[model samples]
Target: MRKFISRAAALLLAGVMTAAVAGCGKNSDSEAKDTAKKWTELDQTQITEAMGLGWNLGNQLEASSGGLPSETCWGNPEITKELIDTIKAQGFKTVRIPVSYLDMIGDGPDYKIDTDWLDRVQEVVDYVVNNDMFAIVNMHGDGYYTVDHSWLLCAEDDDKQTEIKDKYGKVWTQIADRFKDYDQHLIFESMNEEFNNDYGKPDEKAYDNINAYNQIFVDSVRATGSNNEKRWLLLPGWNTNIEYTAGDDYNFKIPTDKGCKADGKRIMISVHYYDPFNFTIDENKTAKTQWGKYAVKNYDNWGQEDYVDSQMALLNEKFVSQGYPVVIGEFGAQDKTEKFADYNEFRRYWSEYLIKAAKKNGVVCVYWDNGYNGNKGFGIINRFDYTITQPDLIAGMMRAINSTDDYEIPSPAGYTEVRKSAKAS
Candidate 1:
């Protein structure tokens, strides 16, 4: 859910939109009847298994400098039916669409969402649903939910909590209403990774607020109509971190929806994985650039297969086994430094191992692709032409889910040859 935009550009956009009203203009008067057929009611586990291999339409709708800019502002092509069709062709069964409603929403009590933005979002969603793929639409990066401006941060202040709850409720109410007609193919994610406190550590009160917000989301959506009553909803853990979320200390609780007549059968927990940050995200060369059995130098000491197994095990034991499912909504290792001889090979291994481990534990895995194809970005596909730019990585993912065999640890040819030559010298 993260993207880069220069400070100057953000300031300029804010200044331009300052004179305009905050809402997305006005809600449309045309109340389209629910023509879409409702999907068969399935529990969380069935939904997760059916979701198969998933990919994120990242850095597009979620890309906003300040105001709601075009999806192309981040240099990604406008999302089209073909793009989703290509994804389906590539063996993906689910698409996670990340969106930001910060600029698209008005101020205060109503916090009205712009109808134009809603229409735009729905149009993109239709492309996914029409193709017979599961689609997830989430509240991506928004300033109001951050640590500095977060309403969830003020745990001691009751009045502040009420105000935050009110605004949060309004936002979801509008969103739920807009997508109410869509069947189970379209899922609503409560929010992206937004949990943070002033102290930068887990706060009990902040966690409480998060639970409240999730409850509000569930309640609001279900009240819209029966279409949403059984809709599969994804709720994220604090910061969407696996350890923090599944940890014994976090006191994470799934919100109960009195309106949901099925008794919380459709709710699923979401947690992200970018474990061994040194290898997955760190830009420094001092960190591990190589991993797996063939890793020549600076191999990651942590985040090996066992690490993945342990985390997945925790989720399965805590949630999945109990009937609630889990989704690894965002997980990827960046190809920031391609100069390494076995970079692509290492990426393939990483992708295969993660997917294999996730599925083994009955968790749905979704890879995060932000559409930046060079250094410091996780771009696998050339979104402009709808082509697979990283075939090895894509192939590895396909092999992992399709193959019945467990993922074998890879030994890169370059790494082995380099070691052999050095020993001979």
Candidate 2:
């Protein structure tokens, strides 16, 4: 277990503010900015290969939840050495740490990310780099759920936007300055799930609003100094989902303010593949879909090369072919009641369709899973804590990504630390 850390909330200008929950500044000793500068040295090809078969370390962040987490929850005891080794052994080169900077914010719910929370977040990231794994740490559900990237949503007035931009500057300025020590392997995704919060509300703007906001996000992430100059950034389209991003009119032009560039080749475009969200998120009892039914276990759905081909056809035409690399940032259907399907089928197809396609094309895939719920065959295994699971799906995808399997990870090697240590020893 890693040493526990604390966090505080930084104050801000309400909806438009770039606020950090107030408290002492976080520990920046290890992740120096000078080191962060090295990221620019990495070109697009290196970024793409390193990102192939990336893994999403979910549930630790609460960006949409409005705050940050107590430092401890940011990994430490939760992430065992075995887990790290398993991911590495499976051929995954990157781990995307989804973080909510609000969970540990403020004294209560006044909205502040505790400073300790930041420290802990950094610690888990360190664990990834320490283990020889590339790490992609970024704002997560927190920025979407409670707050929903308020500034991007344009919740506040014009003046508020400027104020919030400054706040955004302060928030990332601190983060970049702190984690700057890590190598290019330690990447930073600008925002998570940049969707429209007011879909049908009184003040709903057209989807075009999301495009505008994305531009703002990119510009903001860049202004934080050279640390982010050429750092590989994952720029999610306005909604971060495929349908909208691939739409004809909603072109998310790469940002081009003074410092930004065109082609966005260095930046990977993120498009989540939960197309059948009802299937992935809803358990038959609620928003259920075919996901809980036969789609998961059978591998039949996954094996359907046609479905895979079609989806990628559309994706490549709409986005990938445009020159930017893509990533299935999130994908998984829930295994639940009413919607309950055989776990076997669920895993087979879901994995096949998502990971297989990601490999065939130039895209990277991230299975959306947390160390919760045992039935979620999607858990890589049936374990809730995510501590024990199979890496079959991960390995298969890795095989697809690399094309030629010069290095194949054996099954027995993925089980546990004891087994891994035994093998290595």
Candidate 3:
């Protein structure tokens, strides 16, 4: 399900201004910007392929329910090296750490991020990259939450554009400077899913504003010097929605970066997928509990393998083929609901098929996990034990990714081939 505001709350904040003043300043030392590019340089395509399977460390650092900035505020244990090591051991090559700076930054002209908070975030990034896994640090849940007075909402308003741009630039400047010496494996995502009713729709002004913000992000990071000059950056579309992002109506454009132009492609497009809401994310008691070609009941007519093929094909044609790699930053089917009996097998099929389709289309997908081990939670790893809770799901994903047999590539018109099995059915 989409994070941030409830549908009702979103409607209420449609026209409201919840802006809070923020102060900004350069807090990192000159030593932090030392010239050192550690990781081997790879183009965006190679980087995307290298990422393989990924998982999100969600509902922890992004939690702000109790007005606290600590990871434990949401009931998840403090992030530890063992947890990241376990993720690497489970075959996940990339870890996307979503963080919220709502309570970590000081209040308008100067929004300075707390040094300790920046240090804590760096520690987590180190845990992932130091373990040889790709890490993505993004500003998550920092936008569109009415209660938090999101600056992202201001990005869409013409009146507040200057203020929002200033804040956005300051935030990225701090982040880029702090991690200036980190290698290419540590990617900086400009924002999470920043969108609202009008801004998320097919509004030209909104698209223009979003593009401007992305430009600010790229310019700010590039200005930090050192490794950031050619660092990989991920830019999200409206609400990170695949349809809205890849569709013809959004007028989405990749921001230009002079620093990355000479080094080859350094910008990647990001989108989220949880299609067929009735099957993947709908929490209603009457929601469809089963899906896939082999399902005997509750099978969704849409969002089948063919649907996956078409959406992926759209991305490949629109961006991947044009030199920009695509990252499905968040995608998953929840298994915490009791509404479905014997749901694990069906969920496994979904995982395998999605990974296979994404691979065929040259896209990288990262599963979203909110660390809930109980009802409606998306946790796959047991945080308490630092172990994988669902072995079958992980095995299914690995098998799909490791399979050597190639499925026929689908055309823009439609999919025309049947999937072949390389393992026991």
Model 1, 395-416: lDDT tens per residue?
A: 8898888877554644544554
Report the lDDT of model 2 for residue 424.
40
Output candidate 2 Cα RMSD: 10.7
Any runs in candidate 1 off by more than 4 Å, and if so which? 1-36, 67-69, 143-157, 197-200, 405-425
Residues 1-425 of candidate 3 have per-residue lDDT tens digits of 45332222222222221321000123344434332525478886679778988999876676655344667655667889999998888889999998888767776677898888887888888788778788988987666545354566634567778878888899889989888777767889988876664433656677677778889999999998878888889998777878788898776778989866336878889998877777766667657766665565666767877788899999999999998889888887777348765676667777788888888888998988877654455678988897677887888888777675474222212222332321112
Give candidate 1's error at residue 416 in angstroms. 6.8
Instruction: Show model 3 residue runs off by greater than 4 Å.
Output: 1-37, 66-68, 154-156, 197-200, 405-425
Identify the superior model by lDDT, candidate 2 or candidate 3.
3
Clashing residue pairs for model 3 = 21-108, 22-108, 22-111, 23-110, 23-111, 23-112, 24-110, 24-111
Cα lDDT, model 1, residue 207? 78
Q: Show where candidate 2 strays beyond 4 Å.
A: 1-42, 63-68, 71-77, 80-82, 103-114, 145-162, 198-209, 257-264, 285-307, 336-341, 381-387, 395-399, 402-425
* Candidate 3 TM-score versus the reference: 0.86
lDDT of 2 at 364: 73
Candidate 2 to truth, TM: 0.70
True-vs-predicted CA distance for residue 303, candidate 3, Å:
1.2
Task: Give, for candidate 3, the lowest lDDT window spanning 10 residues.
Answer: 15-24
Instruction: Kindly list the per-residue Cα lDDT of model 2 for residues 1-425, writing each as its tens digit.
Output: 00000011111111222222111134354335445444435455556666667776664443232232532232222555566666666677778787766434333212334566676676677668777677877765444424433343444556655654455545655576556456667777767765545432222343444445556556666666554555566777655656556655555655554554423555677777654444454343434333312222212233233555677767777656766677777666544433443343444445655565666566777766554334432445322243445455554455556655333322222122222322342
